[model samples]
Target: MCNKHLMVVLIILAFDLAVATDSGLETTQAGGGLENRPQRDVSCRNHQEYPHDNICCLSCPAGSYVKSACTSAHERGTCENCDFDTYTEHDNGLLQCLKCTKCRPDQEIVARCTNTQNTECQCKAGRFCAPDQACEICKKCTICKDDEVKVRNCTTISNTECKRQLSTSSNKSGAVAAVLVLIAGSTVIVAFLKRKKKFVGEQDSQNPSEMEKVVVDSGSGLSDEEMQNKLNGRLYDSPLLEQAQAVGQQALANKEKETKQGNSFTSTAHSSPASLPTLPSAPLPAPYPHPRPVSPSHPNTRDDDLPRKKLVPLNGDKSLTDCFSYFEEVDVHFHNRFFRRIGLNDNAIKNRENLQPEDRVHQLLNVWLEKVGMEASINDLIAALLHLNQRLSAENIIAKAISEGHFEYEGKQPRDESQL
Candidate 1:
């Protein structure tokens, strides 16, 4: 029985060895099959290649598309040109090119679509669009108000920008304040001067003997008899006498001017002075060196019942030009007639009609200055306004001219000149 058991055990061992060898052969066959089979899709260099059939194929170039994918690894694909109105903007592995963008009705084409680029568009003039936001539609540009000024015009990327105009009312108020201050200062100065004069007058009114003794005491190199002669004649300068003399001189000048005007009118009516060829009369002396002061009680202080303020320019042509803005106060209805009087032609005036009223006034005044050359004067413009019956405008302009220091009222000769 033991011998039988040993043979059985040997048989069993041989059977187990055969089962082990068979299992080993099956495992080796399965490993070999796995090694020979295709792998799963692997990672690709995205810029250079794309995956197809579990392999990486080289990508097509710009302006073209992949008509057929590469069958092998690391190989180029079959590429075809992009169709019209379509684009492939970069090296791509796409089935077909993308459709080009269509600009809206409000937009203008900046660049047309090409194989490698898409269309570019922008809003037309008088319109705008923001680039950062989706441009579903363009927007209308803004218009500035009458009191506002244009800072920048509208463009495709930016809307119109405006700035509020500086108020002319403020300027007028400031000018008025300056005038008040000046008037107040003048009043103070005049009061001080009057007080000083009063003191002198009181001293002058002393007893005659006292006055004579004081004059003798003075260190003047003259005899008492000569000094007495001076006191008797009141040779000391008198303000009242000087003022009366000035009034008389001004009246004489006006009478002379009127007489000349009358003679010129009468002569012209009878016959042309140029044609008559008469001998030239003596040149009239220059009118009184200063203008007459305005006083309702004084008959010679006015011209034709119109209050006159003599305006002497501070800077010649510059003063005239500086006063141009004052003309804006002129009545709108009288603009054409007023400028025409200043020698502006219909065309010259019409050319500036589109400008704002103030701007038109300024521009046309410059044109007038150019035409009149150095002979251009604010006085002439003022006279023209007066002729047009724009008396209020003329007055306002004159006041502005004087208050702004472009001109000064030549009311009196300097004190030193009067003394001489």
Candidate 2:
């Protein structure tokens, strides 16, 4: 009964201590009630690593720190700096309302300071900080992490875009691009072929109107035999005949060229003939194969007295030159090829006297007449002939479109009234 009474008395004392708070709110009672203002203060003189101004307890600044209790109600000295992450702009009296730290420029915001003691922080949507972190500052988000793909771009606000290491559009675009390429290529090829054919035709065609005026007079039609005979007779005095003569004379020169070729080939074959097995006597390489010689015309049918000369100088050989029908020849050889095809048919054919593209070739005749060395005009028959001939000789040219006939000059034909 006496022990029970002691317990009740103890309960009453505990109740009284818990209430009637005048002991400056309250204090941890160690030995007695209302003990001399709790003399043992937490010493913070040595704890100075962070919050330089804040130690055990003191007032933190306004716009900066938080109230985490004071070291004493009486002057316990000024507050030290807040926790490393916490801030106090200036004097905050006894209350230390801390300032929230901003994330660094390269980082994003995590948790904002709040009313509760358990403040939560998180990296902005795409960012993250490692564990054991207060997250006073957050870091930038990771770019594409998948190794197979790479980050193509990272916009200021948008998420980082990942691109395939290889080209993704290749498969689909390849076919379409191929088709477009084929069309373009085919167009180019067709144009090229047409140009080539036109060129060949220019080179080979005989513009009949150039050399001979089509005197569609009140004339009569001649027989085929007469025409054939006339043609055959004309062949005796043709440019072909002149060329043949030149060739015959140049045979020795041609032979020399062949000899030169053989010599060069032999020399080229042996970088150093030391590589060859040395015999007691050396042997020469074989010469290039020569074309088989053609037989001369049958004696009975041959021209018994055709003039022949090694050097037929073209100075004033009226006989050799007059043999060329200059007036008729240029007309027959150039007009149809160059002028007519280029949309100047009627006028170009009619004005078949001069071959002049523009300036240079036009003045060649003058140059030749004056014995001047240079050709002034590029429009002349020879120049046009050269240009067209080069085009015709290309790898992909047509011959038929360029050529009209091998000038087997049949003498004459009467024009029908219907032709007019």
Candidate 3:
């Protein structure tokens, strides 16, 4: 019994060794399914694909084109599509690397839009055939008056046609053609009338053979008087309406003729009759030297033909330096000037006007500060002066600033408006 137990234990040890060997083989062998070359973290994602996913370029197939390019070599944006007008073939490994169709001058297309395919093409219904022109549709034929020339012919895709009657031939040929047309029209009318009558009256009573004769013969099936009456009615009853229509038609034909001649040499779009005329362009505005200042207070009026009055630069007067004194003394000087203008009485002026020269004096100081490029430091005073009348005397502003404790305007080594 002891020997048997020893053999059993040895067998168990051998089985365990075989199992470990098999696991090792599976890990390193190619046929081991997951047998490895290298190991990596499964949670790690590719960083280059931040915005886009699935980073492989697919090839383009034949007969279609790409309209757009991929955002990057890795990130594919939506593909631009092609219609019947364009074509592409080949495994375009991209959404946007497609092709547009090559259309002949006379050809046009109707398309079904798509991202990855070519649209379809068919002949336009109204287009005329052009030799060497790959046309999808034919344009309708234009009808012109006998004396008219076709300045521009219509194509199947477009409705515009130009025609004009340059001159009429004076001869019997024109009259003959007109007469023949009238006679043919009258005959058709008479025949229709006769057929109607015969179908209603004689056919009701006659045998089939006799009814056939009735159907064939009549005074053109209508009386001569009836034909004349219809013609007269058309000519006399609607003359005004017909004349107006004819005039309008003539005007349109003339305009179309002119347009065609114009476009033969020049290629461009014309907006409309009311569009502004194309004149020689003025010189471009330069960025520097500044633009003209549009003053709010304009003089009363001027005449178109009168010579323009130029504004000579108002250079600061040399004496303006002495005139910079402000506050009490400055006030006394401008006070005399204001009353002199107002006829010495406040009642002479408007009811609520401020008579104190100091009010505007401080404003002027601000302007002077701003002119010297110190506006950022004294913007408030400058702004106030901007609203005041330009005619206000300068001395008054100094007085107001001094009295208001804004500055000492009395005796100072300062430059006048000119010197400053």
User: Residue 240: error of model 1 in Å?
Assistant: 42
Best TM-score among the predictions, by candidate number: 1
Q: What is the lDDT of residue 119 in candidate 1?
A: 99
Q: Of the pair 1 and 3, which is ahead by lDDT?
A: 1
Backbone clashes, candidate 2: 33
- Residues 349-408, model 2: lDDT tens digits: 433233333322233333333442342221232233333332222111112111322121
Please give the RMSD to the true structure for each candidate, in Å: 21.8, 31.4, 40.6
Q: Order candidates by lDDT, high to low.
A: 1, 3, 2
User: Mind giving the per-residue lDDT tens digits that candidate 1 earns over 1-420?
Assistant: 999999999999999879766554323246456322233327889778988876899999989999999988999979999999999889988889999999999999999999999999999887999888888999998877666777987889888798998869987997987787677667656765775566567546631211111122233433444445344333223343344445556666766765777767667747854544332122323333223333425534222245444567888768888888888889888899888988989988876664689999998989998999978877678778766656668778877887787887665332221110
Give each model's whole-structure lDDT.
0.70, 0.39, 0.40
| Predicted candidate 3 versus true structure: per-residue lDDT over 17-79, tens digit per residue | 787675543355456456432222112223222222223333334443444445544544344
Worst 10 residues of 2 by lDDT: 208-217
Error of 1 at 88 (Å): 1.1
Return the clash pairs for model 1, or none: none
Top-lDDT candidate index:
1
* lDDT head-to-head 2 vs 3, winner: 3
Stretches > 4 Å off in candidate 1: 1-31, 35-41, 166-170, 173-420
Write down the TM-score for model 2. Answer: 0.21
Please identify model 3 stretches exceeding 4 Å from their true place.
Answer: 1-60, 63-88, 93-117, 120-143, 148-223, 227-420
